[model samples]
Target: MSTIADVARLASVAKATASRALSGKGYVSEETRERVVSAARTIGYVVSPNAASLVTGRTKSVGVIIPYISRWFFAEVLESIEQALLEQGYDMTLYNLPSASPERDRVFEYFLARKRFDGVISVGVELSDDEVDHLHRLRRPLVGIGGAIRGVHTIAIDDVATARLATEHLLSLGHRDILHIGGNQDEQMDFAVHSKRLSGFLAAMHAADLPTNDAFYACELTVPGGYEMGRSVLGDPRRRPTAIFAASDEIAIGLIVAARELGILVPSELSVIGIDGHPYAEMFRLTTLEQHPRRQGRLAVMSLLANLDIPTPEDASESTVLATNLVMRSSTSAPRAPLHHA
Candidate 1:
């Protein structure tokens, strides 16, 4: 097969010069680098990653740990991360496992302890102090998505503020009787996202001087879950809320489906709002807060790659909080009649 020696011979450059040109470690003239690249392509010569790692101490790969692959937000983040890594000529190793599980313990204790990657990007997986310390000891740069982690670089949105904004939007529309449909607080995802969102909703309600008793309903954080809850909650005319703030776009879409099934006109009979800029949101014309999970994923990769240059424990401790924007749509409006207690 073709080798760097062959490429160097074809380019009429010394083997050491060709090696420097291909590795990009030591400086080579721009023209010489291009000539070596052309010669390698002509000879179908490829650099051995193992050999390169032996020389540079870099695997040219990144390890990604995430909790869910089927969920929309996590899926989007994973896709973005993979794409960004590919563009940067880096390989990605994905660990799709549940949080707080025995398998997770093994991966962290055994698999990651080996340090086969140059860096790590954790999406929605809250690493413990010990785990963070382990990676630091290995001198592997770590970056997290979904929430802040002590002593780890992280990129996340302010869940509390985002949820509060969603609730406040409904309240501004004169919705005194508003119900929040979201993930179960008792069964929270990593970083207690469900609880934080619920807290935000309550904070907004209390600020508006509205009674919050029985105002929040727990669900599975999916469309089917929202449909089931909507059927029961909207079935009773006396107890029906004038507006609903869904924790996700899927739930909002499900609630709208249930409302239609019950012969209730949207925005006129009841208003609905949700988080997430899910692709279906535009189809349903749902009002929502666009959190942009893909953006977070891309940012996490960028942050990790930037730190890979320095690879210092101090540089790995930075935190970045992203912003969510409100998207106005046809799903929400002021109540058709004067607001009254349900």
Candidate 2:
């Protein structure tokens, strides 16, 4: 097999310099690093992970914990993280912690305890104090995405603010009878995101002095979930809301589909808005506050890498709040002249 010594000889650099360049550890001049890499590529000199870990005390792999892999947001985030890890010459180990599963506990108590990774990126998975302590004991760099975890580096959009922005948009269009289709607060998996979003919706309504009783509908954060609830909620012409603020673009799309099935004209009869810049949002022309999950994922990986390089326990954990923007589309508009009653 082509060895580091052969690469070093070919690059005309010392073996130690070649090791530093290929391992991405100790600093080497950029020009020298490029030459070493080029020489290594030419010789097909691959660094054995086992040897690298023994020398640097780093596995060069990152652990990623997520709630649901099938969900659109989670999937997008996972893809981004994977791409970033690959670019950084790190492997990724994924742990899917489904709700109410014993496997979830095992992941924290056993799988992560194995010390297989140099760092961890948690997506939409809130770590308990004990779990955090356990990871700290492992001394692995940790970063979170989707919500804040005390003493852990985190990247998240302000869920409440995003939802409030979506709600305020409808309210600005003179929509007094606004209904919110959001995730079930009691059943949420991470950081009470559902509750935070619901709070934002309520805060907006309270600011406008609008009645909020019976204004919220809790459902799954998916298209099918929204479609099922939308059909039932939007079915009643007399009691239907004038505008609907969906917590996610997927839900908004489903609600729109439901409205069409019931022959309800959008914007003119019912306005709709949502969060998340889902791929289908543009196709559906959904008015929404766009929070990029994929970007958030990439940011989390980058943050974790930074933390890994500076392993200082005394350093205060960072909470990065990403920005979101309102994407105006055809789904939302001013309520029609008499506001269709029944």
Which one wins on TM-score? 1
Candidate 2 Cα misplacement greater than 4 A, ranges: 5-21, 24-39, 339-342
Q: Candidate 2 residues 152-256, lDDT tens each?
A: 889999999988889999999989999999998778758888899999999999999999999999888889988998999999887899899999888999999
TM-score of 2: 0.91
For candidate 1, the lDDT comes to: 0.91
| Candidate 1 segments whose C-alpha is farther than 4 A from its true place | 314-316, 338-342
What is the alpha-carbon lDDT of model 2 when measured against the actual structure?
Answer: 0.90
**Model 1 per-residue lDDT tens digits across residues 213-240:** 9999988889999999999999999999
**Per-model C-alpha lDDT, please?**
0.91, 0.90
RMSD of each: 2.3, 2.8
Q: Give the per-residue Cα lDDT of candidate 2 at 242.
A: 88
Leading candidate by lDDT: 1
